[model samples]
Target: MNWRPGCDLAVLHLRARLMRALRAFMDQRNILEVETPLLIRAANYDLNVQNILCQDESTDPRPLALHSSPELFMKRLLAAGTGPIWQLCKVFRKGEQGSYHNPEFTMLEWYRPGMDVQG
Candidate 1:
């Protein structure tokens, strides 16, 4: 049975709870929440990842790619000294749907300056 969006109320409730929990966790760690653009000019050029592109007159007449992750821009912010920032936003990918994956989904990304994976 296909339920309308509002009919699926449990999912919404779960999402809200998760969001609040994440924010509190970040706040405890003194990490700042940020927002980034979903649309980007350049597509990520990895081997398997494909990007969705769209033509728009607002930014450019040419096709613009939807960002798969906020990694690139986040790194730029890190370089510019915006330290310890995290973002929870929607990202888009092309040809990546599966039983556990979707083309469009919410992503949580963060960057900490002067910190490496080993640390």
Candidate 2:
């Protein structure tokens, strides 16, 4: 059982610095940081995305899927009149493994109520 970290201390420090900078940038724009559930009842049905299913059937009769993106839940918040919001969370996808792609990754998503594509 290998217990060492996947990356070195310098990499960890760099990640921490990046996260701080991102948070600072968002704070300056008044974007609230929010957290949503990782496991949800419905899976994303996007053509190229596959969801990872939870194995613990004993907990719930219906299967739960690890969210590939926080879009759905974030949209719900937006519909409920929550102002501009941003989220930094972990997302999971099934059967994705490569040098540049992993089964799990951190995702940063944001929604501004009145912003359009051009903006």
Candidate 3:
């Protein structure tokens, strides 16, 4: 059996460069980069999205759900007076299988306070 990574080194390097560029762009706009929990006590209530439950004996007995998005946590930060913020994190979704859709994927989410459609 052949053993090799799906992504090549060149692709990895390009991805890293792209991420760096994104961070730089956000920083230039005075947007803070933040990180939130991947596993949360509660899952998203969106009916269209399915949350993946984590079962760990060593941790709390209560089920932990993998966050489908950082929107909730980021909103909390916004309520706490945090200005524009952005996050690059891994999100999980269950019952999704396809070439374009993945069970787990990296997502870039951001929140800009006081900005609306007509801003």
Whole-model lDDT values for every prediction: 0.84, 0.90, 0.90
Question: Ten residues in a row with the worst lDDT in model 1?
Answer: 1-10
Tens digit per residue, CA lDDT, model 2, 10-97: 9999999999999999999999999999888874666689999886777778888899999988999999988999999999999999
- lDDT by residue for model 1 (1-119), tens: 75556447788899899999999998988888988777887747555789988888996787788988888888788788877999999988899899988999988998777779973
Maximum-lDDT candidate: 2
Inter-residue clash pairs, candidate 3: none
| Candidate whose TM-score is highest | 3
TM-score of each: 0.85, 0.90, 0.91
Off by over 4 Å in 2: none
Which residue pairs clash within candidate 2?
none
Model 3, position 86, has a per-residue lDDT of 95
- lDDT tens per residue, model 3, 27-97: 99999999998888874667889999988869678888998989899999999999999999999999887
Ranking of all predicted structures according to TM-score, beginning with the best and ending with the worst: 3, 2, 1
Any residue pairs clashing in model 1, and if so which? Answer: none
